[model samples]
Target: MYVAVKGGERAIENAHDWLAEERRGPADIPELSVDQIKSQMTLAVNRVMAEGSLYDPDLAALAIKQARGDLIEAIFLIRAYRTTLPRIGHSRPVETDKMACDRRISATFKDAPGGQVLGPTFDYTHRLLDFKLAADGEVPEAATAAPLQGDMPRITEFLNRDGLIQTETPSDEPPRDMTRQPMEYPAGRPLRLQALTRGDEGFVLGMAYSTQRGYGRNHPFVGELRIGKVSVEMDIPELGFAVEIGEITLTECETVNQFHGSKTQPPQFTRGYGLVFGQTERKAISMALVDRALRWEELGEDNLGAPAQDEEFVLSHADNIQATGFLEHIKLPHYVDFQSELELVRKIRSEAQANTLKEAAE
Candidate 1:
């Protein structure tokens, strides 16, 4: 009486229809416009952009609305859309010094040349939920003013001035692209940053938290954290000049760590760096901490066998898309594998019982 399932095509079609209906929602209620999502649910859009490795906040917002407010699903949509985008060209390395910064802060120093500009932050806000937002209450707009103009020198630059921190030689070498290439063991900084930029916020936070709790502990100070847009340019050989391709919002973090200099050199501090796609301060900061922890050996510090110290472990598990895909895939049919396992366990138990019976009879 057993028959193979034959409704897969119909089931799939029906599922797709249901999903489309759900995304649109009740006919009476006004559909959420992309602009509303972009302006109202900005953080979700930011996260999608951050993880999707796409800089278009509007596109991310649209993706969020299209995906029915599922952030991970929105990221997947943006990534899928991005994958088809042809690589027009590469850009000149953006000089952070030239960045028109919206928000910048340094933890190592109390005051720098630019002073601490607390531009557009929710750091001190109470966690209480606002009921007025449900009714869409109007709020007064703050008076506009130009951003703080003075240059805030990097905190690490101060250490570098005194030869107290590791000196980083700026390289003209082209970094490897993670999306275009498979990740190899013992990843370089460029590759690590690529993965961290797209990494799950919660996962990176946990790894960073572990480090703070004395797991592969390194005394780290937020050497610098900057959020701004960087212009991307590519040189056209025919034109014989670099041309602007696009601009992207980025959050960059650099941390200074204590390192006991080895036989090769004098004792000095080192740097751990993090760079991400958008205004993801938490992720960028966590990434910086984890980055430093991974450099224990390079800095002549004892490994202490910390989880954060394991680069392979941290990089391999930080991505939400990868994690969710692998985890949820277990729900797919695996009857054949389950049957094999069932047979093997039964055989083992039967053998053990038989052996026990023989011993008892003897």
Candidate 2:
């Protein structure tokens, strides 16, 4: 390792200046505003928020812009900024049953209580690009519908009524935040969920795919997936009560899995849950599959030695920021490490040559 940075101070400053110049691009082209990224490039902003463990779309958009659309770098920026913020208070658990749903669907039931609002989605849309969008003319407005009059019952609640699925009792205890403390092995469901929610979407998706491919088979079906806005509330000591602060978009997924019954309990369909910061259905689904895989021990199912079933391995490597750090560090000066390797190689070669000479004489 070098005593300082391999690049001198002037070279580093010059490189940063060059980077800024490159980030700006052509002088003729207009610079992208943060609002454009927030509103138009919405999915990218959502991903940054979800993976970065921060709920600010505007900030995520800014980070995206600053990082020149490199999502992982944007996440790193957000995480660094998040660590500097003061810990005032934590929000109460959001109630998904009461969400103002934008998109809602159920795979288990054709007609749920909510009646399957398609909302704005890519599911039914043809992949063919529309040239009209490039022309920048006024787009046709979407049709509006009246909001549901009453509370739309959750799909799982229906199965729960008949005791067809395992029951998850609500607890008054607060969920442990993984950020507050070091991650300990054999982490609880709360910690695992926290990690999965903020974990890299690709890594989680791969693990989920492995499970589906029979690596750690747990027959999984999407019971319901919903995307919507939920109110965030926090209690203030001075106010003496919880007050609604703001609303944030969220995606929730519940998977119904194969029945796991034991001598003490009757056969019941199992449950796997996923909740993320935004409308990231893929990540939510992947999180649920991996979540189910981790529940093998709790469900009395044998571990199949799959990566998904191994909580420590999955959780530890799922963070892209951490993975990138280890990967990129090798690009730095490795003179000390390389010099030792070079010396060992030289010594081995010299010894081999001496042996060869002695053999020739014999």
Candidate 3:
């Protein structure tokens, strides 16, 4: 019989000490600063902020350092730290139309209002590695262009004006906060989008890919994708007006999906929306796709039994923290369960042999 071993506190301590050393690497090498990670590894910090559901770059950088550059682990650290902070007040919803955009593009239209500002993207860059970066670790200054002034109109708005897209009626009902409240099945669009914004990037990407491969084909076109800094506002009860809290970089994606009209409705384009912290276009686009897929019921489309269409499946498995906990738990001791299974297998084999022998003798 296998018995559980205890008294490994000292061993665990030593193992953690060794792990710290390993994370630091050679003693001769200079330690990496949190600022360095924050500024240089901007994308990583962005991902941590997006997944962790916190926008503090400094804290995200520190979490990245503490997590030994493990993005998921850093996200976990940020989430844990966030839970400890007191909630003073809730911020009024941000207005993306007022965003100071750094990058904006639309695939649905050839000539958008902003004229497809590429801005700081790797889309046109060659995949070839530059050895100069490894030796010098210095980036050359990019050529500057005159910044686009004034608010750029949304591509969806154009469609809406023509009545070519389904009219989205604003609801006065307050959105359910997924963080505070337990998730319920048949979730509303707002709650589903919230889950996707904080969902595991890879998982969401895969689900989105599945949709593209005809799992739940909803002929999606990137209506518009904008990356920018938007002012966050808070409605102060005493002040009688919303005040600007702070600015946060966000990536917003609007996917225009095909929607043949239902019995009562006219044929018009339906939309899927995604908004996440920082410049993560891939995640934003994937989120939009998944969001549209989850809207099957609302759009009156036939549920083709796709994974992305299944609300319970996507929402339940979207969080990396919960998925990691359950997945990594397999490493823990399961000796008793294994032993019971082993004994049962042995007994079954023995019985089978005796029956085979009896049949041969007969």
Candidate 4:
């Protein structure tokens, strides 16, 4: 009798205990509280907020701690948690032009109107590891200047003034919510951008790098990169007017890429855009590049058969939750399918051996 292994329950319990021990590390060491992760691991928390499509850094940090620093698992936790959150209401469209920017830069111009402010970036830092940080050392606060007032002008607006870039008028129409709906083929710009913002950073980076490596290469220049907070206003039906609900940090990148003119058209610049839910410059920039590459068809440019250029390819595979869930599910037992394959292989081999013996006898 072929008996299946027993004690599955006990095995699972022991495995869980081991996992919990591993997650907490040595008992002598101080336990990591969720608040500590939220404040100390700000960058990691920001990434979770961006990719999980939620703005709660606290929740993201908790998810991270719970997941034992497995970022995809953290994202999954946030996504699942977000699904249960009650829908209060939709907010008014955020005006990026009126953003209170902390970091704003443009690669297209040497000196833009507002001037570049490279705030709180690790870009200039050497890659050397700091031994002091091993003991959780604190950095001294730098001198701060008073907040700049008045609205910051968009870099794209300047190009539009000169008739250099394609001019786009603002629409009063409401944009579709991608999370609430299943994505269909031939998605609009809003839908595409939403997918890219919450996309896996590595996948986005690879796609962007592919474009630079001659696959759908469209000479790109960073038109603008801005990190700032914008008010999320919600309309109160009883009050009859929209009021400030809350605010969220965002990173917006706009890329100006070369656009070829058709026989009857004049050459003009087209745009690739990205907007993420935190200060993530690299992800935002990569997202813009991939966005531009995917716009080849819309801008009347040739499709160079790049992975990034394929809208369906990029949007469909970008999310971490979808990718990880499908991948890790394979670890679950599929003995029935394996048994079928096992029987088929044995039968085929046996039949081949028998045919060989028959030929030898003849």
lDDT tens readout by residue for model 2, 76-122: 99999999999887888888888888888888989788688887789
C-alpha lDDT of residue 286 in model 2: 95
Best by lDDT: 3
Q: Which residue runs of candidate 2 sit more than 4 Å off their true CA positions?
A: 1-6, 146-150, 171-173, 263-265
Per-prediction backbone clash count: 1, 0, 0, 0
Error of model 2, residue 235, in angstroms: 1.1
- Displacement of residue 137 (Cα, Å) in model 2 is 5.1
My TM-score estimates for the predictions, one after another, are 0.90, 0.94, 0.94, 0.94
lDDT of candidates 1 onward, in order: 0.82, 0.89, 0.90, 0.86
User: Which residue pairs clash in candidate 4?
Assistant: none
> Which scores greater on TM-score, model 1 or model 2?
2
Q: Residue 158 deviation, candidate 1, in Å?
A: 2.3
C-alpha-based local distance difference test score of model 4: 0.86
Root-mean-square deviation per candidate? 2.6, 2.4, 1.9, 2.0
1 against 3, candidate with superior lDDT: 3
Compare candidates 1 and 3 on TM-score and give the better one. 3
lDDT of 3 by residue, 1-362 (tens): 55666547798899899989988989899999999999999999999999999999999999999899999999999999999999999998888887888888998998897688888889998989999888987777888665455677788899998899987888799989999999998788889988999999999999999999999956899999998888889999998999998899999999998888876567899988889999999999999999989988877778899898999999999999999889998888777788888889999999999999999999
Evaluated at residue 254, the lDDT of candidate 1 is 90
Q: Where's the lowest-lDDT run of ten residues in candidate 3?
A: 144-153
